[model samples]
Target: MEIHGPGGISGPDRPELKPTEAQRPDKAASTDKVADEVNISEQAQLLEKLSQVPAVRMEKVEEIKRLIEAGEYETSERIEGAARKLLEEL
Candidate 1:
């Protein structure tokens, strides 16, 4: 069976595809002299530092777990410190 169409796939009637500005090789050469810049705000840097910090301190958690298991997690000093922090927040 023979298929017949307007241009039969790569005929002269098809418009040539041109490279977009981003795809042009000269675009990169022209931009080579121009240095790319990135300025991170103080808040962004602080947030990045925060991201590097572990969300949970596993060692502290494990220590607390052990203390609680031994019925020694709650102490007068810890209670006083917690109460002080609570009052300070108010």
Candidate 2:
């Protein structure tokens, strides 16, 4: 189908085709299956409780600093694989 724009050019634009199959994890999907995850008071209480704990263990902090200085880390390689799969689905 030709969909003319203000520029007056036309091209094929079909909507019947499926989405590109990129798995967008919609956050709202959970709403239908579960009650509200947290109430304001409960959330405040939880936040207050969490605030009482030490932010991070000293040993963990040191390990993280050491890793950062030494450049020791890892990255997931699954993104490319997932993209390939989604393209295939499309």
Candidate No. with top TM-score: 1
Candidate 1 achieves a global lDDT of: 0.86
Local error of candidate 1 at residue 14 (angstroms): 30
RMSD of 1: 9.4
Alpha-carbon RMSD of each model:
9.4, 27.8
Instruction: Tell me the lDDT of model 1 at 22.
Output: 77
Model 1, 22-76: lDDT tens digits are 7777733653477799999999999999999999999999999999999998999
| Candidate 1 minimal-lDDT segment of 10 residues | 1-10
**Candidate 1, backbone clash total:** 0
- The global C-alpha lDDT for each of the candidates, from Candidate 1 onward, is 0.86, 0.70
All candidates: TM-score: 0.57, 0.29
Clashes of each: 0, 0
lDDT tens per residue, model 2, 1-90: 454667454455443545554765665666456556845798899999999999879999898788778866333545577778999999
